[model samples]
Target: MSTSLKIYDTTLRDGTQGEGISFSVTDKLLIAQKLDQFGVDYIEGGFPGSNPRDISFFAEAKKLKLTHAKLAAFGATRRAGVKPEEDAQLRTLIESEMPVLTIVGKTWLMHVHEILRTTPEENLAMIEDSVRYLVAQGREVIYDAEHFFDGYLDNSDYALRTLEAAARGGASNLTLCETNGGKLVPEVHKIAAAAVARFGRDKVGVHCHNDSGLGVAVTLAGVDAGASLVQGTMNGYGERVGNANLVTLLPNLFLKMGRTANCAKNLKELRDLSLFFDELANLRPNPKAPFVGQSAFAHKGGLHANAAQKVARSYEHIDPALVGNRTRVLVSDMAGRTSLTLKARELGIELDERLPAMKGLIDELKEREFRGYEYEAADASFRLLIAKWLGQQKTFFDVENYRVIIERHNNQIWSEATVKLTVNGEAMHTVAEASGPVGALDKALRLALAKAYPQLQTMSLRDYKVRILESNQGAGSRTRVLIESGNGKKIWGTVGVSDNIIDASWEALRDSVEYMLMQS
Candidate 1:
């Protein structure tokens, strides 16, 4: 196996094939820049000939002063009868002016005969001619043998011949693509090993999808079989169960497998890069994702938390800080005093387990959890509860009363809220209107308190999530509201639960404001 592997990222091109995943020209350019900064060897921009958006992206991407990473333009092999120079797609690849050209050609004889309706000889000619033409045009060609694994299974001789054809055409690398994403690790290792033996390790690569949930596994298998280049997308964004997840694969390679890459120096930035992609994609981050997820190092069980607090390695496989994540102690009904103490320490609070109040705090926390208050994601609310129970919290203000009104006028619905609150023995009243009741309430509360606390101006609701508990009760089910608030530099979560959704939301909203005041 190679000591160092080339990391080729196709998130902008192949990842867009995923449902609900699309990037504007600017988004693609931003991702390319980030990938370069993260030490990627190659960033595959979209197919320039396929879409105007991708063509525009390449035009704009050329303006970027990338520190690392060569841009690769993706396209298919030339049409069966067309000369490479006259092929429109090949010409577009040249016009994109990317440093590298990735051409995907059919490896499966079935696809050659049926999909292209061309003879086997012509198919081989197409692969060789397209690569030879691109190489002659001053482009470094990486030929992707699409469906290479399936083709090798059906006709090993023809599949090997396809790779040889690309090799004969001056291609720098031959990437075996598990396009269908159905091959298991063993077979993938066997086929990839054979390719490595034939083409040499430096000239072999692997591209895999996750249909069988083996994308990452098979990618590792390929590396074990001596493939030197690994092709994947971040967060596994691709069509039908997605592609190999580089976010997961990189750690396995550099950390677990003892391999090296240029990006290994920035391994700690993995989580931030993952989050940046999620933000640009306008998708929620997966809390359960491995290595970088919120829950990746979270300890909830009393025994687990206790052991983890005593010895970090007792429960954790690796140091969370190695990947820019931290150990999280989740306090729940199952938590012991040790878990509570660890959680308090996580919040920068010192709690003595010997104190009689410690047991009381644990009991109160369990009782709150029984009432459907989850603190795992609502650290602010839990901190407030601790402060109140310890008799150290000061009341910033008292809510006298609040009311919301929803009315339909001129065929448009509007919501209005009135908030009455007392700050330092002085009563203040404010009214605000918005498109929804929650928005109106938020505006009204801010208006009422803005004068008393100027910091309230910086605080705004970032996210609001509502969950219905006890489905059998239907409309009367208890609602849990979790609100996330931020003040430019800091963010916190607060949670509330009640039979009435409005009341639950108000509880969470109130807690958010109180937590901010407490910290301030």
Candidate 2:
């Protein structure tokens, strides 16, 4: 029977090392579970002995029954002249009781001589001794030859000797690392082919980094050259450019290359997984990442949208459903009638080609987008604009007048806001004081809306972003405020621009409430 390629993920170990990325113990476990659902063969948790959070992750992860993947602990090989049994880090790896352990060892002669400050003979001994000790302790060891490709190119004999040490030491597998990740495809093919020839295909693995932007290509070369195990990170997280993104690489290999049996995962889930990590990290998802990014299947141009509407494959490289991503027909100034018709159908609104309202709405959308009001990002507000254009939106309430009073006390600013509103044919007035003008206005607006729509009491603003359209003019400059509000079930965003920041905030706040009320 043919075997599938083994996917080893190091997102928790290597991904967390990425600049500006730090995962709590709980975050690691959540990501681990997501990888398991992605059909990974192994999940490499961080080095158990290096940090308390990682140690806690290992302890907690082992208690959960993972369905598809085995959790692995990562660490360096034992120190020179020290037995693995006596090494505290190695002992910690064993205590984690994970089914697999990966220990990296020196392969490049330069590293052996300079970084390790040891003779080649001692480096080989370290490799052999470390693997043997781990195997003796009943742990399955994968010996990673750091910088193996560069080492193989510089000194073929020494590189082969390092592998021989691991083979003789009872290592279950030996992985070649492109540690600097500067290698090209031809070089990776050459080295991986030679390693497979020397070590036998079953005993070899590939660990690639993305510094040169060729990590995925190099990994594919290694696989083609008969490396059975591919090690990388989810979303390509790591130091510098990052490791090979297995999320993208896997689908490419499975669907495009036909190398492995379909893992039965909904490819669209990859998007959710990527966004889940971004949310956990409090970072925005990349809009252009392959397979799962926001723009992966988004079409904006008229010709492209028209072509995609007729034959999606003409514009899309692959079916979006293959990776759990949906094609988004973005309506912009460039969008044509085909794009608008498709979007209307998606929104469950009938498309009437001769309707002047439809054409007017498209024109209005283009005009607003020209001023930096991005309907793509402010989707809820865009929906309201669409509904109003169609004469289908209901007016929840009307604002008669509103005023904000700013007072200076002890060199500090205070704001008192008052609003007069008509709700369901009745007029009501309310006043609220807050730390700032916008805060006070928002407080007063919410209080007034709550009287009519009781559900407004549960809503909260989750994120607020402000951008200065032109900053050269300083405090008097016109700025844009983008507000994202959520009520647990749904999220809506709106944008407002003005010279007065308070007015911009009020506009955004009013649009947010109006969008929510329209949804209700």
Instruction: Estimate TM-scores for all models.
Output: 0.98, 0.93
lDDT of 2 by residue, 1-520 (tens): 2446778888898888899889998888888887787677888998886878987998898887889888889888778777767888888888999988898999899998889888899889888888888888787888889999989988999999999999999998889999999999999999999999998989999999999999899999998898989998878889999999987887788777767733435455777877887888778888999988888999888789889989999999999988888888777788767777776666666677677887788888788767656656676776777788878888888899999999999998899999999999988798999887777888898898786798887788888888887688899888788889999898878888788777777888889999888777
For residue 353, give model 1's deviation from the true position in Å: 1.2
Q: Per-residue alpha-carbon lDDT of model 1 for 316-346, expressed as tens digits?
A: 9889888888999999999998888899999
Model 1 vs. true fold: TM: 0.98
Clashing residue pairs for model 2 = 267-323, 267-324, 268-323, 268-324, 268-325
Residue 93 lDDT, candidate 1, scale 0-100: 93
Residue pairs of candidate 1 with colliding backbone atoms: none
Best by lDDT: 1
